[model samples]
Target: MHLTRTWTPPGAYDLPGSLAVLARGPYDPTFQVHAGSVWRTTRLRSGPATLRLTPAASRVRAEAWGAGAQEVLDGLPALLGEGDAPEEFVPRHRVVAESHRRHPGLRLTRTGRVLESLVPAILEQKITSIEAYRSWRHLVRKFGEPAPGPHPSLHVVPEPRTWVRIPSWEWHRANVDSKRSDAIVRAAGRSSRMEEAAAMALPAALARLQAIPGVGPWTAAEALQRSNGDPDAVTVGDLHLPRTVGYALTGERNTDDAGMLALLEPYRGQRHRAARLLTLTGLHPPRRRPRRQPGDITRL
Candidate 1:
């Protein structure tokens, strides 16, 4: 069975940017950019669906196949950021404002799949994105089901119960240390509540997710950005974001998380949007020295 949907963008729509936000890496098994279209899979309350989204002038064309086709169709608009109002944000920095003016098409998307975002966020705790993405690709390729329809290369993310069942040895094999793997399992144990929290108020949802021992502000914010499109969701505790945001705003490379928050306070409800704009502007604190990128332990 197939389901089709179309969405006209409220402004300039960069389909790749809209979809790239969902993909963890170029090697991510669950999401991929291919042939000028986005191919992805997710498990809905009904079942798993694989979708192909093709970009058109001022419109997005989507087709879904599988048991969850109808649900994916229903969620397509929100996934395309139909619920987001980028205009609501008032940038506090000259760089941010200029980038916002230049990139009117950049919008925060809300997929409302809490577990889908949460699990990967867990894998990312204290690890470099490359390590996290590789871990995600390995685990999903091993445990996830083949996406339905003709796109067998795609994989539907496993249910929370499956995540919980992955053994400690298996996590080690995937190069995911005990801490991050355990966090994912613990969060998966209450998958129903987590998914429900996605629909709750943003603060309430973050609080609910943070109830898990390993889930923290940073992980919760990352999950909310993807699942709820929380514009104010500022990622805390990142190794580079504080410096990046700070340098873009204050020309200071010595800034920390507190400094980043202080600088972002002027934007208050629109901090994430402001930071995103600054990031798009290609402004950065000059590199004094190359920081060591995280190496994959699983290959060692």
Candidate 2:
């Protein structure tokens, strides 16, 4: 489809770096292939051009090509590195900036939609990430839109209505319990409101999401970590983060959320960024039990 209209970041949408940066998402073909969440394909066009991005109600459509491709791809880090931290947290701005510079592609990923991030974050609550990604992949393949364009394998996230309307049989099929399903449905019910939250500041956006029935600190932090590139919104209550952070900063294997926060306090607004760097720095606690074991409740 030819877009004749205009945008503030005109041509900015066509650039991969800018899109990846703005979205703080993964752009690697491998990631696109392995990650069921990424829906990508080339549009048959006459001449050379890079990608195009359109902000839909639930997805960002991207297309790209030619010489401009490199320019577009180069801008992602700079774009996503822009943080939404409050002025009060500005003291650590340099730290974040430096950290991003130190670890250019670290934890910054540009997932296509806010709800995509939100739903997974909710699914991960009090559970393993293996379980969360499993549930996400299962549900999307079952209920999501067949992504537009040639790559039929690409699937957009399930619409809020779809989540709210999912049958119990499908939930069992996906191994999602009532709690996770409930949170997803409840969040979906407020999707319209959450979409509006995108325009709000980080704190406000997180606050609105937190107002939902089941979205709590971990989920909100997870959402904002990408939604607004919020620096201060650390994912507390994580099972392994404390130990990871503790080991990275203090060379110890023990730390609670509070202690992790304290250890990361020096970075403040950029705590998440630092955590991202630490993780990317290969500083995780030494192979704690062969990563996390998956729990498939569907078997039970």
Candidate 3:
């Protein structure tokens, strides 16, 4: 009922960084991070599955359990960024170059599951990550199934049908606003098409996703970054990214989405990769004061 596989990074790979991208938030329900291992429970096409990744001297050892164990094993390489070519990047900024040099092993992961990403991405729209994560955690704990085998403590994300069926009251109780909750329900209803869309070319895939009412450029970009390890999928409409990118690239504290795109034009085919490398450096735009917190819609 369990399977184990091994993968060695092509040259150098940051196992933690690759996995970190999949963790929706620090309090994410589905992805669990431990001292030296990463645990993830997913509802695969085959069935629910759990994966534990442990780093070794030169490679990672992956153990999976459940009906979808083989699927998880097959996708392990892509998830760990086996297909990503980080060495080929040529950064235009000195700080970015330093980050790439420091973490030559950085790689982008591809999950190949759109609905899974879509649900959380919807919950995350226009809200602080903490708020979104809290809602996600509440929903998953209430609906997700227990992880198979000895990993009894972990939980897999609920199936698409379950997502569609979650009552409006439950969503409100989870502190999810009407707009996001409705979008998730609609997306869950069309989860199959979204999964099929993942096999298409990036442009087509995004278009198919955006066909849904609530999916937009930002949500599509975020999903594609995980679903396909899209190198060029730069996230727009982010509250802080433009400033962060602009400040790091040009030392300008004020910038917008258009400005961020303009500044990243030099690395057109690898904008997301560039942005991620910049973030790894822990550089941020200078802040004058703390930003306002997200409103508690559940209270209203």
Candidate 4:
């Protein structure tokens, strides 16, 4: 069955920018940009669905197909960032203020599907983006079901049970190491509990996610940032975020996580938003060292 909905945002809205965070990479099977609309596939509580969002004059037109069509249609507002209060975010640094001013329509998106975010976040742990995105693309294209809709190429992410049952060789073929694979399996085993965290307070939700084996502050924060639209879920252990944030905020070339936090103290309740604004400014310290190469685990 097909379903449709149109939503008018309360203020300025950047449709593509809000949903861009959900795409694992440019070639993500579950997400695509066709024409001017955004096409995305997801496994809702009811079932799998494909959603197409098109920007109109002053609103968005949404269409969905499959068993979960109604659910996806119903959640379109939240998914497009109706739940996020971008106005509450006050940028203390000049760069942040400039980014916030330039991208007034920018809003954080909340998918409200914990496992969807968690699994990809797990795959990204301590790895280059190239490696992590390739693994995600390979695994999803192999295991995920074809999305329901006009777009034949889109695919819905696998269910939790399917995630648990993926064979070891398939994972290896996808270049997923055992450590990350094990974490995905473990998290999948408790998918119901993890999904429930989407409704809990941010701190409690983060704690619940981190409770899973091999999940840490970084992973939990990454998951919640999408699943919950958590404005303050600042990623703490990233390889480049601290340096970028420090340089944008203080012109410091060697700021660690602690220093980054200190610089962001003024934007306590919206630290992640501040970090995002800093990143949007394209301000980063000059690279003095070679970039980390993407690992080729299949050779090992």
Note the clash tally of each candidate: 0, 16, 0, 0
lDDT of each: 0.87, 0.58, 0.86, 0.92
Cα deviation of 56, candidate 2, in Å: 25
lDDT for model 1 comes to: 0.87
* lDDT for 26 (candidate 1): 89
TM accuracy, model 3: 0.97
Write candidate 1's Cα lDDT for 1-300 as tens digits: 888888898878877776677999888889988888899899999999998999877789999999999999999988988888887888766888889888888888889899999999999888778888989998998999999887758899988899999988888889998888888999999998899987887789989999998999999998998999878888888888889888887788878999999999998887887777877878778878877687766665
Q: Using Cα atoms with residue i matched to residue i, what is each candidate's TM-score against the true structure? A: 0.96, 0.70, 0.97, 0.98
Which residue segments of model 4 deviate by more than 4 Å?
Answer: none
lDDT computed for candidate 4: 0.92
Q: Is candidate 1 or candidate 3 better by TM-score?
A: 3
lDDT at 254 for candidate 2?
74
Clashing pairs in 1: none
Quickly count the clashes in candidate 2.
Answer: 16
Q: What would the TM-score be for candidate 1 when compared with the true structure? A: 0.96
- Misplaced by over 4 Å in model 2 are 2-102, 105-113, 287-292
Q: Per-residue alpha-carbon lDDT of model 4 for 6-79, expressed as tens digits?
A: 99999899999888989999999999998999999999999999999999999999999999999999988889
Determine the C-alpha RMSD for candidate 4 after optimal superposition of all C-alphas. Answer: 0.8
